[model samples]
Target: MNGDWLLRGRDGRLTVYLPSGEAVLCRAERGPGGPWEDAPRTVGGTQKLHPGAAVGQGADRYAHLAAWRPTVPGESGLVHTTHFRPLLAPLDWVPIGHPDKKGDRTGPPAVAVDGPGRGYVFVRNAGGGVSLRNQKVKGGWGGWLDLGGQEIEERLAPVAAESGRVELYACAPGAILHWHQEGDGKKPVRAAEVEAAVRPGTLRALATSAEHTTVFFTDDSGDVCAWRPGEKPVPLLAAAGPGPVSAVRCVIEGHDCTVLAQRSASGRVAFAAYPTEQESAGAWWTESGPQLPSDALVAVALDEHEELVAASLSPSTGTLLLTRRKDEPGLALEAWREI
Candidate 1:
């Protein structure tokens, strides 16, 4: 898998993506926190880490794709079974107008869960409106509700999820989408003014348990904004190299959380992360280099503890940098904790 990347689930199932395409069932079981009995779950189909696993409900293994992209998956169309196989009807191409004009976008419609099945997906619509879509999972199909709308923009990644559905943020638009599981009915109601700021910034989504949510973004000048929603957005490492922050990936291996962000300078891509207390990301970015299927894309997933996992990509290039923890520093790769 030599393309942009996304960690789909805690099952450690990696989705190697290509510009306008992707390859599913890329990697296999590794590290920890996954159901030991179901250590090796395959991609495609409604494969759950455990038979008792439910979507954002009960005490069971949490299952989700590391990320989503709207690309055609190598002209195969993301609706193909090799990418994602649902029993639902084949998705008819809506031709949301010119997909190219929209800037940097990722995979198909996907949702990250913090509390329950409060459907949250990325919508690539007309007039370059980069937005978030929410669907309530109550044993029925809930019409996709629009969340955040980017005036004129491109791609995005799965922001964050916790005890309560917080903000779903993305990049190129430098905005955030907000959703809440409302009134005894787990319906993800859309709210206006979800955009956190107007300053250009890097947008990264990390998953975790019912504890925290992480949103990473970068500014036009190259400064990064790490947001936790209700909390103020903080700056991670400064843009030491040339280009803006390319991508950011958050992964949970054992007990620690790690974020891998990519920076493209003089056409060179470098990936790194900012760790946190809890692995609070369901998806992230992967297009750091020119190696991803859809060029720039998003990633997300849940570990066995139902904790969140993720990664991110940059402006283009399409290469991915994964983040797990670094045992040397108590993290997975080289990261320690968010602090």
Candidate 2:
């Protein structure tokens, strides 16, 4: 799946979810350091789901999954499922219908949960603008609200900052569109747009501060660039890789750092680590593990031990492969193991 597949729960557990056949299958660790469960658990009532799934976790420790499914023949609608406990059980899939009633047309969805545990889902609408739906205070959901934009790409990046404010980023024809909350409990309004030619399906955002986030994406020339709300785009690495890049912030050697992973042109998972938000300081990409079979989606997250964990689905075999960051040096990872 293009969206995040690796999730770290508030209880210090890691769970991986992926699309299997027409259902979403997940596997999670028994406890913190993980002797992960052997077989995959089928999320109840997701047999008709589409291929990709995007997952997000909230402050309440609930994991939210978003996917699209056929509501009627030739028409599709958004479906969501929430997990009360990690790897235990997920509630039934709830339908959040499309923004347009004439025809159920929407792109893949991305979800983010605010600090107070309310969840928000975003997708590109039929007219190529962004639309959002969020969880109400008492329960249930609010109606779909169109956050206007045009020619937006399918891949969306949504991140909730430490201030409990949610921010969204989308790639358009020749620029990146941004939206954010002005105050607590406020809906995100369209903000400044960055002029950059971003490659489709490559936008990724990481919250680098309490109120702001830094977005990373490959520019039209295949170079990786980092940009924040007010700052200019900072070019980080050139010819980094293909497909979307995965990143997570953590403490390394007592210094706040951001670690990134992407699929290299040679089919290997490459890694880079740098001081958080200091892209101009310079960072190098290093190829890690053996080359993957093809353009497998690579993802990274910090485990309970605060070590970096990278995961990807084996496109050739449909197996999940995982590797952890080595304790030694800059962004090194242990050997890859399948589960």
Candidate 3:
């Protein structure tokens, strides 16, 4: 689907979810040192998922998945599934319904989990506005709350800051709309919009500090740009390719770094690392391994050993490919291994 296919749980396990035909199948590692399961396990009741799916892990360490199902009889809508444990068993796909009933129109969802382990799902409503539904403290879901915006694009990025406040970013026609919570467990209030021409489906958010997050997206020129809440947008890498860029924060050489991965224009996964929020320092983009299919999605995360791990789906072969950062040098990755 997109780059949100990989998830790292609080227990140090990594799970890779892929949309195979009509179902969303997953394979997770056994423990910290994982040889992932030999075969894929189908998430229960996900037989009608629309290929685009988003996943996030809550404070309870459970993986929450949101997907759009467009062919569900009379009214097409969105569905959600949560893993009961870290190892990928006991999943039930529950329908979350759609906001617009006339055309049953809804975009792919973006999920975020607050500090209290409640999950929130966001999507572009039929009227080109943003709508959100979240879980209550007692584990019940609230109704869809329209978080007002106009001409919003299909891609959405949501990040839960280290302080447990969740912030959302959406790309509108000529601006980037923002929504944030004043404090943890509070409703997200819309903030002033940032004017920028961002490429649709290329927005990603990473928490760089306790209360602030840096959002990265491909600009109109195909260059990657970084923007924080109240700061000017800083251009980073140039011509870094398309689709959603994935990022994870880790410590490298005793320095905190943000590592990024995206599918390059040449059909390969490219990576870059720079000091967190220090965009002016410049970043070196490196293309790793052989070329995957152009539609392949890339995701990066930290493993139990604190090593950087990257995963992607091979849509043509219906297999998952994985690689880890090499210890010897700068931004090097071990060979890609199919799982």
Candidate 4:
């Protein structure tokens, strides 16, 4: 499973998106530390590349994949599964067009879904700006709308924070490019900048609650930073290398906390946490996580209860090894049960 993306679906399962456009779904047991189960086959009937995961509510609660359209050669497309189903067989795959006029676009399209099942996909076109499309509730797919900007330098994925308002973000060179839409029937506000950038492909975001969405990425100096809306980016602990960054909002020691994890340049995994009620973003990060053998860290996702499910490519097997922590109260990294 040369997975490219990790995301948690509304069904409380962690989904791993592979380079071949297939997906593997894992679900936890009723309690903490038992065996986890995976679907019998590859879900999401996608035969393309750069798979993205988008989970919406109600009827649209299924996992959506936005990837390079293998059928169309150079364009991108959108496909979705039935809500909360075990097998993520495609409900529909729509060719929504690409951002660039030519060549494969950077990475897979990023998707965000609203409470009512409205979906938005973002792609960095060959023109260097971002291209977007919308799927309205009870309506068909809309046309491509170019939100022009050449500063986006990499094939970083996009994350959407949906509350009453919906906000989207992408990693740009030395900044975080953002977009948002508020109110019914109103236009979206686009491209707000947060001056924090890391190596391409390392940015990640988590919508902790309805009121707060935090973005994290390794900076140029190898330090991880956390950014919230209307606040400056807060620098946290340093990493040995710039790999991937992931965060999960969970209860630890009976208090809400965000567990931030990253892979060092040397291929070791590390994690740290801070209280959700803490006001300062510059809080220290404790190095209490378990180090695992990995070539590249793929994706990290949390279930409905905030139990973490992380996948990394095994250096020896070249397959995805899945791990989850025991359900206990401790800041230190718990022993991971391999699936």
Candidate 5:
């Protein structure tokens, strides 16, 4: 199978979702850079599954997952878990929403968690509309609500701001469209589009601060561009990588930092970081990581200790490789080690 994986590491464990509808959960007893003492366990392989997305609820020690599936024949829908703990699996997955019988899901659904452990799922319908579902604080899930936009492309990703606002982004014919319910529940969904000069691939969003929420994507020109709130898109790296890019917000050295990882056309996978404490749009990107196979799928995240870890999937051999980087007192860039 042509597999896609979404990985998340937190609270001394890593959760990996395979395209075949299986989730492999691992526990890192010696921490992220150490060996996974427990044997990885797999769950849920009965149905066809799309790639999955995950987000952690800060301080609650819980993570939420959302993945698209055809639970019923000819019906494209979403399966999710609200009280998911990576180290503990065999979850009771719940069906939240589905497309109309005449319509189908156009792409993978994205998931994000707010400060209160509330989860949000965003998916694009075949009719070119974006559908969203929210997990209520008390219990159960809310109904599928239309965010309302025309010509919204198939692929979309959701990012939850620290301020409890969730933003959804999609690429259109000539620009990228973003929709969000900014304030209270009564407000209508706000929509905006940035006229980017390049086509986007694998879009990722991060709410860096109250002042700046950024979206990063791989452009058609094999470069990484950042789109800040209310501003035009700018190039973060000029032709730095090929293939795909992944970005996440994490705490690094007591400051909130944006970590970007990419695989180049030459089969080399590397990462860069931009700290929020710095004020330059022309920020420097530090590269550190072992090279991965050209065909490998890559993912990056911070462990419980806030250290950086990168993982790659070699589909041909079914091998998953992980690399970890440690920051020292005076080191500019630390070396990456395979775990």
Candidate 6:
């Protein structure tokens, strides 16, 4: 996968980038009936799954992006070492197949929890209905579990890997399913139904935080709402600041603090933080939208100590990047620091 994740507080700026380094969907859905912004949420209302369309012949198709370090900051520098053309499945021994035989899968997205291959994957189709595929890396990628529910428009699946298990989540109209990965040797794990806050069938964003995973929903007001990991989700909190929030991220150890990054309809990067405590959800979390050099912020991340680290904001093309501490080289990456 050429794209990398720029994690911010669940209430701050968020974005996904292509291998070429250009970004897309960096903002949230604008006013009602609007197209998705260049921000980080999935495709919707005729929008294509990004990074995927960007991948074609001679293009680097991200086979799958794996690995995230939530506990450490330094580890954040390189979250995923993507597999190029000769795509390498995480485990070589496991048998692989396209969960989306219809080629609707925006590449394959799966959740592996526990060991090498004990998770479920929900692949998409343009006509509607998702193909649920389960597999045990050790055993084999189980068969595709057909989870036929009302289709969700512009839905992107997020997965979790741990405890020799994998979980797949998707949204359709009014219900959610906890579809488990199964195989020939293994029977399908019963799919559990859950509620998605707000309208029954709006596209939601999901990400895993080590052992826990959270789902985010963009409400009618265009404000971002979230659900709890592992358990039934409850409304957490709205990101603070005057601008609307675009995306939410959970920070891990040795990494940046969890962030909520928002971009206004006009194009501005607003950052917020996801609370370590559940009580913090109701209140608007603290937010900061420092006037950045760029017209848009492509990515946002926090360091372990909760200090804001790197952000791919619209750089002042005419401004010269000075030395870090007045002595650092003009070399990229090391040239940025708080003034």
lDDT of 3 by residue, 1-339 (tens): 543567777778888887887787888888875878888888866466667788886656677888777654655777787885658474677877777753455677889888887888888898889999888767788888888888899888998888778899999998887899897667799986788999887889888987579899888987889999888888998856767788999888778899988888898888899999888889977898778887687888888788899987777777578998788656778999887
Q: CA shift at 180, candidate 5, in angstroms?
A: 2.2
What are the per-residue Cα lDDT tens digits for candidate 5 across 1-339? 111233444456655543333443333333444555445554433444555544334335455666666655656667776445555554555777674433445666767666666777776776778777887767677777777666776667666666666677778777788777666332227567887644545676767778656777767775677787587777777545655466666766676777777766556666666765243545444455555666677777666666666777665555666665557531134444433
Candidate 5 differs from the real structure by a C-alpha RMSD in angstroms, to one decimal, of: 3.7
Tell me the whole-model lDDT of each prediction, alpha carbons only.
0.38, 0.83, 0.81, 0.57, 0.60, 0.37
Give the C-alpha miss distance for residue 234 in model 6, angstroms. 3.4
- What order do you get sorting by lDDT, best first? 2, 3, 5, 4, 1, 6
Q: TM-score: which candidate is best?
A: 2
TM-scores for all predictions: 0.51, 0.96, 0.94, 0.78, 0.82, 0.50
Ordered list by TM-score, greatest first: 2, 3, 5, 4, 1, 6
- Model 1 weakest lDDT span, ten residues long: 50-59
lDDT tens digits, residue span 143-261, model 4: 77777777675444444454544565677667887666666423356746777756667666667666767777678887777777677877777754567666667777777788766
In model 5, what is the error at residue 209, expressed in angstroms? 1.2
Write down the TM-score for model 6.
0.50
RMSD of model 6 against the true structure: 13.2
Query: Ten residues in a row with the worst lDDT in model 4?
Result: 26-35
Residue-level lDDT of model 2, residues 104-133, one tens digit each, is: 657888998888888788988998899998
> Compared with the true structure, what per-residue lDDT tens digits does model 1 show for residues 53-135?
10111111233332332443322111211223121121222222222333333333333443554434444444445444343
* Cα RMSD (angstroms) for every candidate in the order listed: 10.0, 1.5, 1.8, 4.2, 3.7, 13.2
> How many backbone collisions does model 3 have?
0
Q: What's the lDDT for residue 327 in model 6?
A: 22
RMSD of 1: 10.0
* Per-residue error (Å), model 1, residue 47: 20
